[model samples]
Target: MDQAIQGKIEEALKGLFTAVSMLQDAYPGKPFTPDGRLVGDIGEVVASLAYELTLNEGLTKHHDAVTDDGRNVQIKTTFGTSLTFPVHHVPDYYLGIRMNRDGSFEEIYNGPGHLIQAQLSGRKATKTGLHGGLMAMLKRINQQVPDSERIPKR
Candidate 1:
């Protein structure tokens, strides 16, 4: 990475850490681990910005985003791991995103909910057990999407 770009990324991460720390301080009882829910939220935010999708912050059935074309998108993100099956609700499409340790996107999978569910149905829920199969499916799906549909890496 360029020195300037690296510096910018470091600055952004500091800001995110400060924000999360403030939230933790405000709500003492909540579980806000950096590696858990925080990363997931960051992933969602990144996806929303990348795809220009509208996020549903309130309680919703299944989908997290609504596209301009009226598609309901459910985004599931993991850190180089497989997403668990039997999500609370099913959406029109399932978007599986894998993030790097630094919270940058590594890969993305977009496909029908049923197809993704079927592919992951019989797998063990643990990260170690599900990673291989999930990655394979994600790679296949990733290839299907046009470059226009994907977010450009900065």
Candidate 2:
């Protein structure tokens, strides 16, 4: 289980980088920051999309970047359709950065409602019994799409 979670965290980080690059390309010269909230650049956006990594004896808070304005961004990444939701509500907006087999990235949006908002604002999105549902959903999505087209570089 530890290895699996670590692998997921590594994959998430790689994907986060790709998403950041895409955001930078899209925004051009705009400065991105990650302060209190992962706010600012595309990299920060990618960081925001990441999940909090829990290891054997440590907790890793994954985030994007911070700006002088004090706004944090959660960049949710995926390889396929932007229509897919998250396995957890750890982010604010779902910035879908679909990666191509040829080493390219595409940015898309899935909207922000329950996922990040609920967690950040002290709302509940699911119960303990329903935890497996997200894993199942992600697994199904993985089975449906080609590995080469997944957003992050896994």
Backbone clash numbers for all candidates listed? 0, 24
RMSD of 1: 7.3
Where does candidate 1 stray beyond 4 Å? 1-33, 87-89, 101-103, 121-133, 144-154
lDDT of 1: 0.63
Cα miss at 61, model 2 (Å)? 3.2
lDDT of each residue in 1-154, candidate 2, tens digit only: 2355446655765675677678889998963322222212322223334323211122223323222233233344334333233345444323334443232344443333243233334424454311222323343334444433323321
Query: Every model's Cα RMSD, please?
Result: 7.3, 17.3
Q: Candidate 1, residues 1-154: lDDT per residue as tens digits?
A: 3456445655776776677788899998984545656666766776776664677886466677877666787777875456543433345766778765454566557756666666566655663333343667667767876665543333
Residue 149 local lDDT, model 1: 54
For candidate 1, which ten residues in a row score worst on lDDT?
124-133
TM-score of each: 0.60, 0.29
Alpha-carbon lDDT, every model: 0.63, 0.37
| Weakest ten-residue segment in model 2 by summed lDDT | 51-60
